[model samples]
Target: MAGVRVIVTLNFPSPEAAEQAVAGMAQAFKPVLQEPGALQYELFRSVDNPQRVILMEHWASRALYDQHWNKQMREQGAPDQEQARALSPTFEFYPQANYDLVDGIWQPLDPADRMTTIRWA
Candidate 1:
């Protein structure tokens, strides 16, 4: 199965707020990085707009992604919309075939080959 990709954009009210939010989020990132099937999770700040932050995540499979969500629900419950709104976060998910890092480049799997699920650590 292709891994799941999640892209989240956070637009804060100000650069200071974004910086503070990033610092707060840093505390949460280590635990996530230690989770099973967490292929990659990274945060980036926009060079032109310091108030903008972007998160990129990859999971080994849809099942793992769902597991992560369930775990979050059990631990933190649903996120507070009011608190989330303060940061203006936009999230997007892609469930299609994933790419492989080959020779320092990302290479998409052949459509026919992608039907067979492959796991990457």
Candidate 2:
């Protein structure tokens, strides 16, 4: 089975809010790095627009992703997510875009029409 890739864009009111959100999320999700099925978790900030942040997560399977959330919400009862959301009233979480890896190439799961080949420099 192919793995799942999740990308989310967060638009904050200010750079300070964006940075705070990243720091809180990183600390909150630190345990996710050891979670089963967790492949990659990366946070990025736009150079031009410091208030824009991007969160990228990869999981071994959709099932694992769902399970992770269920565990976090039900079993762990973590409130970091809620706190992060309170950072800014204008904080926005754009719809998450989920993709799948096909033979190491990433492609949108819904359409699977567009493909992205990543090359590390």
RMSD values, in order shown: 6.6, 8.2
In terms of lDDT, the poorest run of 10 residues in model 1 is 112-121
**Going through the candidates in order, what is the number of backbone clashes in each?**
1, 0
Error of 1 at 86 (Å): 3.4
Best by lDDT: 1
Runs in model 2 lying further than 4 Å from the true structure:
75-121
TM-score of each: 0.74, 0.61
| Each prediction's whole-model lDDT (CA) | 0.83, 0.72
